[model samples]
Target: MNGESAMPPLPEIGDLAARQLVEGTLAPIVVLDADLCHLYVNPAWGKVSGLPASAFLGRTLGEVLPDLQRPDDVLRDVLRDGQPREATISGTTGVCSPLGQRLWRAVYHRVELPGQGTCLCGIGVEISSLRRYLDDLETAHQRLALLDAAATRVGTTLDIETTCQELVDLLAPSLTDLAAVAIVEEEFTGAPPPPPGFLRLRKTRGVAPPGMEWLLRQLGGPGPYVDVPRGIATRHCLDTGRPWLGNLASDELFQKVTVDPERTRLFRAAGVHSLLIAPLITPSRPVGVILLGRAGASQPFNDDDLVTIQALADRAALSIDSARRYSYEHTMALELQRALLSEPRTPHPAVEVAARYLPSGRSVLVGGDWYDSIPLPDSHTLLVMGDVMGHGFQAAVAMSQYRSLLRTIAASGAGVDKILGEFDRQVAQLGLDRLATCLLAVMDPGAGTCTAASAGHLPPARVRPDSDVEVLWLPAGPPIGTGLGGYESLTVRMDPGTTLLLYTDGLVERRDTDIDTSVQALETLSLPADGPLDDMLDTLLARLANGAYEDDVAILAARQRDAHD
Candidate 1:
């Protein structure tokens, strides 16, 4: 009856104490005995795995789970080495229960229980929500990269077809592991309110199969397929103006609505698990859609992937829109300049006039350089070439204005110097902010007379009908508003069958090189007067434009034929 006997030797509950500590105190409690029986499981484990305590208790671990017996398995090492193992379990689906599905993230630990020897325990945590959060973060990062690339590509190029192709190029490699782009018109029905649809397979990455056109044609009507109801990313994008993904294998909306089961099956056979479709949306509506596919045993793409693709599609749309605008403005600028550059009524019947404009190779900006051969009423011709400061629309506007002013002065029969004086006054009074260089030449047919003036502009080159090239570098004056002086005329005689070449400075100026060198180069490259006027001009341009000029060049070449020749 000593103190130990009075306390009944503490009941030898060391093992029970350890088990209680695991079951009640740990975050996700699990207990197992030497015989591989699960003796206890806590609420956290049941909540995570959606399994009850009864599911784990009194069961042989190996009999319940086959992965445990494999030597290379993660759990087996923890048991043999008596070490706690941490690993992410892949290829396991979430557990479904009445209350809702919960995903299990399992952690297995090996423990030694006194008298019970070695045991294996597992603690599970619910991480379904966390997994979704991480997925979202990944998707956002991808979207940002796509947008940045799209913006860079679109901002630099202005050719619509090339820009469109670039967009497809960007998408092809990322989505389908190949480059492909297609453009198609949206279909509209007049009667019976049929489902909306769009064109397909206007273009593709690589060569499309033979029946692609026919297949696309057949896609409009009812058919079993995983595409949106309207058969286009355009339709959905137009309707929603938001990014969307159609999961072929799992989406009930797709399954219920699709008509072409064979096409769906064919896609699956080709290893395309799903389609991530993004709309090429202009602000008005969706013009096209870029379709991306995960093919060849690749896991189906997730929402994040769809988002990135959507961002790229947006940039493609914007680029196309901008290119169209710029092209329209350019055409209009050319047309306006042409309207101002009307041909004068030719007095001499044998004289033929021709001109050409060559764009600079390095810049997309259109220039204000222009040429006009205005036939005077007095059996003569007024040949003019001028270049306004800057290029593009503004220069074009100035060129149009100058053309009007020159025509007005020529109609009044003023001398070249007097006409230039009037222009200087008009330019300064209008405060136009634009400066220009101009050269004007008036030739009398019967008189064999030529009088030319320069306003800081390149002088014309004379080619005798017999094909002798002579560059005329007359005394130059200050530019139109140079404040130093107005222009003066220089006189020359034009023998019968004379040819005069008036050109903008851009025709003779080369970057980082002397004007004389460029002029000499031009002289060396001029074509003989044998072909048609258009052909001769083309040859001259081909020779001059070697992909180096930074400004537009305008040329007006006049050849006055002899009375008999």
Candidate 2:
């Protein structure tokens, strides 16, 4: 903006002194004529370029370093305007470095010598190493971002197939053009690796661009893929516990393993040029393989990519193993509950018994809650519902013991209050530590009445034939195993066709809400009184729970039929 110089120009120096100073500096200096052809070069230029000064003199950059990009226009502008240009960056090729190239940041200015007119002088220094370090930092940042995504994206559900799907969804189009996760069939997580011949894999999920769909189809689609023996790429990943990267065109092991005709044709047709495979190994053993493929014009898989791919795969593998263990425990707990909850036996044709056990959609849903129907003396039917405190295998086992004891005690035709009092003493004597809530009622057909009692349990609802539903006023006692039994019973005469509903607290309890509020809410709802016993119970659950329950539910509904009907 100003015509005046920012500072005074350097004092004039002798020609010999200027030449010596230029030659002695480590920076490479070169002078070019107005035509941009090299006019002179210092000795430092020879050492930097690994060529004599004559190689640059009198020649254009195109003639000397044809592969390197030259900023000819910038130099011409400097020679015309007499202004200085500083820190112009460029890359040079065919240099004497190990990489056969170097990066340079240079300064250019217009200069006049005695015999020559105005020309451009450039002073440059190599910056290839610094540029490489910066590039490495950027690459590392991108890799960290990907790994961070894998933590949240993978294994949000505790299911084996779902975990497999999450892994492929995270990798495809990011690490490769195509990706798939194949789990070894029958190879449970945390188990030892199976023998090679028995290694058959089932592909759980494959992801790719829509255009690449045909490629996945041609490669036998999802499987039960053909059994891969020891030399195959997937087999290599399993055997070595390391990633395998290969080019389909020239990798010897890959070609030998995929010698079949259909695969060979598919790879060629799909333009799939490269592949990277990593084993999904948990701490115990290899569970599956991550298949990443690059097709058509995509860069081939390299070792640097292997590190990121394997890290993501490892994260997914650990989560999958955790899910598998949880599923196993859930199944075991549910099986134990099922064995204890066989169909309730109706004492006589006069009474109808309908029960439902709805476990919530979680691993803990298998624990605690249970119901049963037992026959008593004098053709009476005993209805029961209970929930052991806490959840899991231990709670399930405790519940089974409680249900078994109740069945044995009810056989003696004891009244509900006396039976519960006996239950408290027996469980306390048995050293059952977990508290349990229970409701027991006996429907006496001959007497036309239902008598019930509770042990820290919810009240039973009586749905009259006219649709008048009310939770009976049953006295409460400490939960079983409290050993402070002060039990009481309430009897209500039931008209024929009236239904009695018994349930566990899971049917109404919710977080942050008063238990009485939830119970009163249930009482306000209109029940399907005239419908079949099963339909009425279903309607009750649909209206009350509505898929929002976090705990298991056990409900039993009983109605006494008219003697003729």
Candidate 3:
């Protein structure tokens, strides 16, 4: 006792001090016995749990608050193990004012009371507002990411149907349970219409119930048109250029949007709980509408969802409009090309003739490729094949001018060389800046001879009655409109049962093969010895033009008959 200094006895706390400290502190404090029966609770506990002290005292934790039973079990474990623990629990309060839900961080400890034996003490701090703020921030980031992805995925090409499909795929299974795109029929025809016009279902991406599936199939995959009747929510949205959000709680609401009774029944049977209809609008007018729906298992669409979907629809509208304009222009260009290249004149009865024209498939613009046959005065025929250097309206116009001038000069009885010279001079004098390749042949069946000329064009191929194929060797000249003015002609003997083929480069040229290889391939091509001229031409095109080409093609075939026949 003398060697070891005794520690000073700890000072005892009064009941008044302990009571003041527990009641004045802001943190929620509660005391429960080992049996999970609440012995005491501070005022702060009442403020957070929305319960008074009277409600908590002298009652088992499960009997007073059922939602907190899980957290109370943790305190019971602490009492048994004599070890303290800390955890966060989330639950709704009994008396809700403005806070709908709450989270709490509670620290549980086993303590020994002066008169009540062993007990569990819990102190909790509220963290609901901070948790809510974080959740909101996360949702904002997700919306931003979705918008960015939509911008990248939509409008990859100038194809209306493809763009519509892309938009539908993006919204389904991510934003809604079902997604569909409907476009105006007038929009496809390139016609302007008043508001609330008919819409055609273009594409869909989701599975519906049996009833809704039957209705969708009846509307046609991409054909049938449905009118947006007055008083319907979709029509109102289109007329006002706004989005419509509704809860499909009753058949009456579904019937208001759908004109057919069967459709109304089908929609209600599908168990759709929420609907969003957004108008596909541009600065000029509304093009169509996009419909999205959620079934019973999914959450209803809110204001945020409506705003996001409307923005997506706006982007898709601009893409579709651009594609429609391109389609209109393509149709016009095709018609113009067809009108310019009328059927070739029937050559003399002694010669059999056939021709074909094929435009490039990679783009909408038409190219400058033409073929013609003019009957000369002396039982002869003049065959012409040419290709302009570029595509589009300008190339087509240049092609027409070249063909017209060539016919005018040839009709005056000009020879092959003179015709090429005159056409070159006229093209330069007229200030036509485009370049072209041309091959001209004058067949004189009466004289048993043929005269041919080249202007940077490929040589013609000849097939004899014995199935012998050969490419005529001639001096190549510069392309027309170059103003160089150097052209030449070759004369070859024409025999009975001999066929000649003249074509543009597109027939033989390919991106993966060289020009020389393609020319050789064409020169060695086999043809039936006794086939008709039309049959031979069809066979050649079918064999060569099996896939998409980078340029336009024009081919003319002429066959000479026996004198006796």
Point out the higher-scoring one by lDDT: 2 or 3: 2
Q: How big is the positional error of residue 160 in model 3, measured in Å on the Cα after superposition?
A: 0.6
Error of 1 at 549 (Å): 5.3
Evaluate model 2: give its TM-score. 0.76
lDDT per residue for candidate 1 within 465-546, as digits (tens), equals 6666777777777776544456789888888766778888777787799887777665565466644556666777776765
RMSD (Cα, Å) of model 2? 6.8
CA lDDT of 494 in candidate 2?
Answer: 88
Index of the highest-lDDT prediction: 2
Q: What is the lDDT of residue 199 in candidate 2?
A: 76
Model 1 ranges off by over 4 Å: 1-148, 177-233, 249-273, 282-288, 294-298, 342-347, 358-368, 389-398, 411-435, 443-451, 463-469, 478-499, 510-520, 524-528, 546-549, 561-565
lDDT to native, each model: 0.62, 0.79, 0.77
lDDT, candidate 3, 402-445, per-residue tens:
99988898897788888898888888888889999899999988
The C-alpha local distance difference test score for the whole of candidate 1 amounts to: 0.62
Which window of 10 residues has the lowest lDDT sum in candidate 3?
Answer: 1-10
The positional error of residue 445 in candidate 1, measured at the CA in angstroms, is 5.6
lDDT of 3 at 21: 74
TM-score for candidate 1: 0.60
